[model samples]
Target: MNSRTKSINELILTAKRDGRSVKYVSDGYHTFDELYYHRMILFSVICHANKDRAWKSWLHDDGTIFNDTFIVGIQTDEGQYTYHYKTEYWDMFQVQEVPRAPKYDGHKPKDITRLLTL
Candidate 1:
């Protein structure tokens, strides 16, 4: 399939629907949704390398709290918004630096581990 034709949301949804294991990368983006007066927002879909679980992070510019996930990191104009999936639940944070991923175990594919580190 031509990945170039799909949006981040589409790619993630497709992967989930097909039961295919794949990761994603994007050069920061914004999407418009009518739910909040067509506000533009940023998000990321995190795929765990060795598990069937995935986490989604929604970066809220207005600091609106979404009760669904636990909050972490710093919420400020200068902080980076991050989301982490832990023990069956998702957590959100605004960080100065992206959280370090789990260390490589030498079992999963290199492509998956390459983007993750201790």
Candidate 2:
């Protein structure tokens, strides 16, 4: 197994033990202190990709395997936002592009569509 796969596996195990839902934030807008949330997001993203193979070959040839860290934040009832961590530098992290779900040419069949159709 490769480093990325190993890391992902370890993360998956951690998430299973903690019992938290995973989310993916490509914008790198989260803080490091929210390690649990971050790990959860990463796991979700990887699992969505369906590349859960244990070998390194599962990753893309470019060597990039979903680059973004997870962070925690809370939205206030008054419409304000708060981060879990305080820092002087916020621009250091760059936003990443998440994979888009395959689009259907027209209305999708109910059996295959995971999303609800209007």
Candidate 3:
């Protein structure tokens, strides 16, 4: 198995032993309802390499596939956003710094919205 896979496996073992909940968010504004212990393990492996960001594995609820890697980016009012899957894959387990989305008129959209919404 490749190093990525191996590291994921090891992470899985550790998470299972620790019993921590694993959370994953996608760019499309979707979040995992609840992640399995093993899945959290895989996430930990990815996080280890990408400390500045969060990582996730896209797997069927039944745990059939776990090859896809998702990296966390900026969080918004909607929810946490992730980098494109292709980008994450091409980086070879490297975490890409999520560019701070351009600010609008010296304030972020969320900041503006927060003021208005509240």
Candidate 4:
């Protein structure tokens, strides 16, 4: 609906298409609608991952929905991304972009920045 939600939806969709599980945990929600929306998103992702795709059976089951201060790391071909969403009233969230680091073979040295400094 909103820009933030649209971005989140895009991220979730990308993750789903790539056959990756999205880690979504919220500290708290201001309104019931917010909570419900989050839950539905989570459910959709989980269902997409499931083979049967029948997650409604467990909807009424006992379980904890949200956790406080849970950190999630997402790994993609581009790089690793760490997402954190703290307790905010409005539709606000933080996405920390981390560029992919160069790989090292260990035999030959790569990224001579440290060597250059010395």
Candidate 5:
């Protein structure tokens, strides 16, 4: 496994436990802190491309897995809005609460499609 990927994963675990957020906005991946910002973007793209639009992370070596996903973007005929994507791919992801079916009350014919948790 790539050490960079491993370090990034560890940082995410720590952040979730502390209930705090990180902000590392450099392209350099030499340090654990530097991986925060880039990890968010990379994971979003990966999740968005996946068939199920979710990422499975084995947080510990014990083999337990957690599903992670997020809303990456929204689009309508008016414009497109890309999410800032602040969460990590493997952090406390995927809401545990049961989801309710959506209600599209007054959307026009050119309504936006679903903004999936990718």
Candidate 6:
């Protein structure tokens, strides 16, 4: 099948209909299981990868698809906006738990401004 023909929403819906796993990746991404186990919010889909951007799935109650990549406030009814699914739609973004820095064990040495001191 031509993966490039499908959009992110199409891919997701197809997976849902066929009971298949949706393929996704990120700059620092783990498997779906890892995301689930780590407790993350699977929300909206976008074409761009912005570190500070977080999108939540917003579908129309009347079954309408809107291709808006630059959504204000990341509201609902925002379906897949990217044109190519093969290359662009694969990177899935979500809000996951970032690893915390190692706690300081009363070590009065080195730079205190450093976030991680292990």
For this target, which candidate reaches the highest TM-score against the unseen true structure? 5
Candidate 5 least-lDDT 10 residues = 95-104
- lDDT values, one for every candidate: 0.33, 0.33, 0.41, 0.36, 0.41, 0.33
Worst 10-residue lDDT window for candidate 3 reads 98-107
Model 4, 1-118: lDDT tens digits are 9998898778778988998765543335344446655754553343244323121211111332134422223332333222223334112222232232122223222432222221
lDDT by residue (16-105, candidate 2, tens digit) is: 689854444122665444664565454334433432211111123244333342222211222211121122222222223224212223
lDDT of 1 by residue, 1-118 (tens): 4666566669767877998654333334522223222211122222223122222333333444455533222122322223322323332212222233222232332333332431
Model 6 lDDT tens row, 3-94: 65466557668777998765453225686556643432222222123324333233232333255421111211322121111223223444
Looking at model 1, report the run of 10 residues with the lowest lDDT sum: 36-45
lDDT of 3 by residue, 63-118 (tens): 33335543333333433433324324434444444333222233333452332221
Residue 48 error for model 1, in Å? 23
Please state the error at residue 50 of candidate 6 in Å. 33
Of candidate 6, the 10-residue stretch with the lowest lDDT total is 78-87
Q: Report the backbone clash tally of model 4.
A: 0
If both were scored by TM-score, which would come out higher, candidate 2 or candidate 5? 5
Better candidate number, 3 or 4, judged by lDDT: 3
User: What does the lDDT read for residue 78 in candidate 5?
Assistant: 41
Please give each candidate's TM-score: 0.22, 0.20, 0.21, 0.23, 0.25, 0.23
**Superior by TM-score: candidate 3 or candidate 4:** 4
- Alpha-carbon lDDT of model 3: 0.41
* Deviation (Å) of 104 in candidate 2: 28
